[model samples]
Target: MRNILTLAGKDFRSLATSPMFCLIAALCSVMWSFTFLRSLILFAENTQATFNPGPSPTLQMTVFLTHISQINLLFVFIVPALTMRLLAEEKKLRTYDLLLTAPITATEIALGKFLGAFGVILILVALSFLYPLATYPIAHFSFPPLLAAYLGVILVASTYVAVGVFASSLTQSVVLSVVMGLVFNLFLWFLSQGAESATGLYMTSVLEQISIGDHFMAFIRGSIRLKSIMFLLSCTGLFVFLTQRVVESSRWR
Candidate 1:
């Protein structure tokens, strides 16, 4: 446990020192904030124009959903930047030998790295909360759905991070890892969108059942379906398992 935490801490420090992290974080923060602020202004303007007795729960829900919906796009660009170095940098610097040869197990190493990256992601996600918090006075947002929406953000962001970690494990070059990460994430995200167009009714049902986007919607709508949560967690576990296997294979060679 201590070893895992220590390794995670080391990863956190490494990311903190990297200019790439700074660039990506600054870029995402600015972009998301500006977009959120713009949306708030537009929503407010529209509400005033409508003269529909001001803010209702329905209005709040729609605005919140619309705002959270775009977060996946942010994750698509930033998650790759955040995760490309997890294992790939080890190989690039010839540190894999030292890492694999250490007393720590591959599972521990993977978990530690995931936790480290996730910690940073959580901080960024929290930073994004500023928009909602700032709007609380005006929107009078309901805590239940709002909290659930944040959970959706974390889960969806985590899905991207998991794919990025697996992609990084497959290559020594961070650029290649980032490219692969984007491809893998876009594949899953697009599939969720494409599912509805399946040829047969049964196939469509199956696709909808597995649709990442729909599951995310469930969270945004304040429905904590066990199946949807499990699907995301299973995906995370699968990638983490694959990453550990990658490390284990390289260690034995």
Candidate 2:
């Protein structure tokens, strides 16, 4: 346990010093900020023009949540960029052997790296709180929906980081890791889309269940479902387990 904490701390510090991490973080911040500002401008225009008596609290919440959902798409790219180098860099520099031979187990190494990367992503997401905070004055502003959306984003981000970490373990080149991660994410995204288009009712229902966007949409509307939480957690665990297996397999190489 102590070794794992030390390794996690070291990984966290290493990621902090990485120029790639800084560049990706800056890009994500800028993109999210721009999206948030645009939404605010549009909301201000809508609110100032007329007193639309028909705009209920539910409608307002829907609009705000949808806008937030759009902004979170940026995480799809940013997460892969952030995690692409975690294990790839270690393998590329042949330092993975040293770490593997140390007191730490593969599970500890994988989990530690995952936690460190996830911590960075959580901080980035937290920094975007200004978006919802700024909207409080303009809208009916229920905290439940906002909280749900943030939770959804964190789950999505954690899942992506796990996938990226597993991808990173598969290759020594950071570029390759990023490409692999993107491809995997893209496949899942496309599967969700394809499922939505299926002809059979039962098939579509299953597809909707598996759709990341579908689950996220529910949260955006401030509806916290246990099923969605379970799905996100399951995805996170699956990928993390896969990453551990990948790391362990490398020991025999």
Candidate 3:
């Protein structure tokens, strides 16, 4: 456990110091801030206009969060970029062998790297809460829905990290890892698209259930379904397990 935390801390520090992390974090912050401000202004204006009869503050805030969560789409590219170097760089620098032969087991190494990457993502997610928190004093919206949306975002981010780590384990080239990770993320994100064109009800149901976006929508709508939670968690665990297998294979090579 100590070894895992140590490795996770090292990877977290590594990512925290990188220039790419700074750029991505800044871009996301700016975009989210702008969106929040615009939405809030519009909500206030509509509320004051007698003819408008605008939505409730709670609903308006929920919509604002829904818009903010769209930033997760941007993470499809950002996460792969962030995770590309986790394992690929280790292989490129030829340090993977040293680690493989060290006291750490493959599972520990995979989980540690995952935790490191996840820690960085958590920072970005935390920053997102600032806007809502700042507005809460004036808006006084419900906490449950807001919390649920954040939960959805975290689960989606976890899935992204797991996929990114698995993709990173596949190759020594960081570029290849990014491409593989993006492809995997896109496939998972769009999995439900198949349901749209399907003729059979059962086939459509299966595709929708398998989609990462469908489950995420449930949380954004303020409904915490057990199946959705399990599905997202299952995806996270599945890829982490795949990453462990990939790392273990290095012992033979």
Candidate 4:
């Protein structure tokens, strides 16, 4: 346990000092600020207009949820960059042998790396949450729906990190890891939408069940379903397990 935490801390510190981390963090802060300002500005305009009988459409659940969804798009771009070096760079620098010969098991190494990367992602997500928090006092938004959407955002981000960590384990080239992660992200997006066009009931059902976006949409729409949560978590666990396998295999090479 101590060794795992030590390794995880090292990874977090390594990323913190890297120029790439600064660039990515700056880009994320700028984009999130712009999106939040745009959303709030729209709501302020609505409040300024003459009162309507209908509910405030400007500050509805969709508006806040859209901000979360928009962040997911940004995740698709930066997550690969964030995780591409987890194991790939270690291999490239020939430090993997040191890891392989260490007293800790491959599972520990993989889990530690995963914990570190995911921790960083959660920090970014938490910072972005301030946007929604900014509106609560003025907009009177429901907390439950907002919480559910936040869950969805975290789940989606976790899935991306899982895919990225696995990709990083597959090769020593950071470029290859990024390419693989991007392709996988795009592929999942297409599966979510493309399933609507399928003819066979069983086949379509399978595709939709596995579509990360489809499950994510349920939460975005303020629906809490156990199946969706399980699905996302299961995928995360699967990829982490696969990463462990990769590390184990690399030990012999």
| Superposed Cα deviation of residue 159, candidate 3 (Å) | 0.4
For all predicted structures, in order, the TM-scores are: 0.92, 0.90, 0.94, 0.93
Which candidate leads in TM-score? 3
Which numbered prediction scores highest in lDDT against the true structure?
Answer: 3
Candidate 2 global TM-score = 0.90
Which stretches of candidate 4 lie above 4 Å from their native place? 47-60
Residue 122 lDDT in model 1? 81
Weakest ten-residue segment in model 3 by summed lDDT: 55-64
Candidate ranking under TM-score, highest first, comes to 3, 4, 1, 2
lDDT of each: 0.81, 0.79, 0.87, 0.85
Steric overlap count per candidate = 0, 0, 0, 0
- Give the better candidate number (2 or 4) by lDDT: 4
Clashing pairs in 1: none
**Residue-level lDDT tens digits of model 3 in 116-182:** 9999999988888788888888877778877888888888999999999999999999999999999
What ranges in model 1 sit over 4 Å off? 51-59
Clash pairs for candidate 3:
none
Candidate 2 clash pair list = none
lDDT tens digits, residue span 1-253, model 2? 7776787788778887788778876776787677667766766677778688875335236455655666566677778888888899999998998888897888998888888888888777777766677767756555876788788888888888898898999999999999998887766667678786799999988887886888877877778899999998898899889999999998676
